[model samples]
Target: MTAITAPMAHRTRLRLTARGRRLLTAVAALPAAIALAFAVVSGGAALATIDDGAPAQSFATVTVSAGDTLWSIAEDIAPTADPRDVVDAIVRLNALDGAQISAGQSLAIPAEYAP
Candidate 1:
């Protein structure tokens, strides 16, 4: 008769169980979630940054009335601006050859200026 022998089971100290595998997966996913949130929050901020300071504001359009001069209009558009510069802007805006005034003519006034 042949002798019967049972196979021996080997032990491993570094083996991972199901729980350890689940823990590893969770740890890996945490950073991905945080990175996704960061991307969502920060995406639009750079686009809004100063493209040479946010494209200066849209110029204001005004209907000229009697007694209104280029100096007055420029002051109204940008009170802090130098009068000469304002005059130049107004001249360029309206394409005027001279400082002539008329009623009911519309002119574009620039606002929120920077050099």
Candidate 2:
């Protein structure tokens, strides 16, 4: 019988090559580049919404009288404009909880609708 000899096992080691290192670097930088691009795009879009030629709007004061309602006030102030829009603006300007108003109360009206 011939003598049998055991073969030595070769050990394998993991090493990152130049191509692998470059790929890893690119992957790490991808999110930062995307975030920068998104910020720039959103900033530009926000700046575009501003209108330089539009006139500045102003407000005026109105004293609430007996039997006065928001709908009636809006119509009287801005008959040419939309009553619903005017009422909404009045509500927002006064920071009122509802359309309820009392006598001797002061309210702010848009200058365009002021008499």
Candidate 3:
């Protein structure tokens, strides 16, 4: 008589509970959260850096006239320099909104063009 044998084809699937899934997700996100926090904390250090090596710039004051524009002022102040460069310097020095300047507005000219 031959003995009958069962075929070994049984497979088991691994399943995680809701709490286990949440714990796994938290573990996965912890490193990314830590990295973001570290970046934010480290970036704050750059904001307060003071450059003591550079000397404070000196500026010459000029009052705007009724028809004076940045281009015209730039040309009048620095005839030897490029008007665009002079205009950009003037705008940056005065923190102007644009090329617009009202009458009687005092503007600070860069020291390079001071005369």
TM-score of each: 0.44, 0.50, 0.52
Per-residue accuracy of model 3 over 1-115 as CA lDDT, tens digit each: 9999999998989999999999999999999898778768987443333334223567889999999999999899999999999999999878888887899999999899987
Computed on alpha carbons, the lDDT of every model, listed in order, comes to 0.75, 0.85, 0.85
**Order of all candidates by TM-score, from best down to worst?**
3, 2, 1
In model 2, state the lDDT of residue 43. 78
Regions more than 4 Å wrong, model 1: 1-57, 111-115
lDDT of 2 by residue, 1-115 (tens): 9999999999999999999999999999999998779769897554444544222456788999999999999999988999999999999877899989999999988776787
Best by TM-score: 3
Runs of candidate 3 with Cα error greater than 4 angstroms are 1-57
In the range 1-115, model 1's lDDT, one tens digit per residue, is 9999989998868988999999999999999888778767998454455344333365667888889988887777677879889889778766799999688998776554422
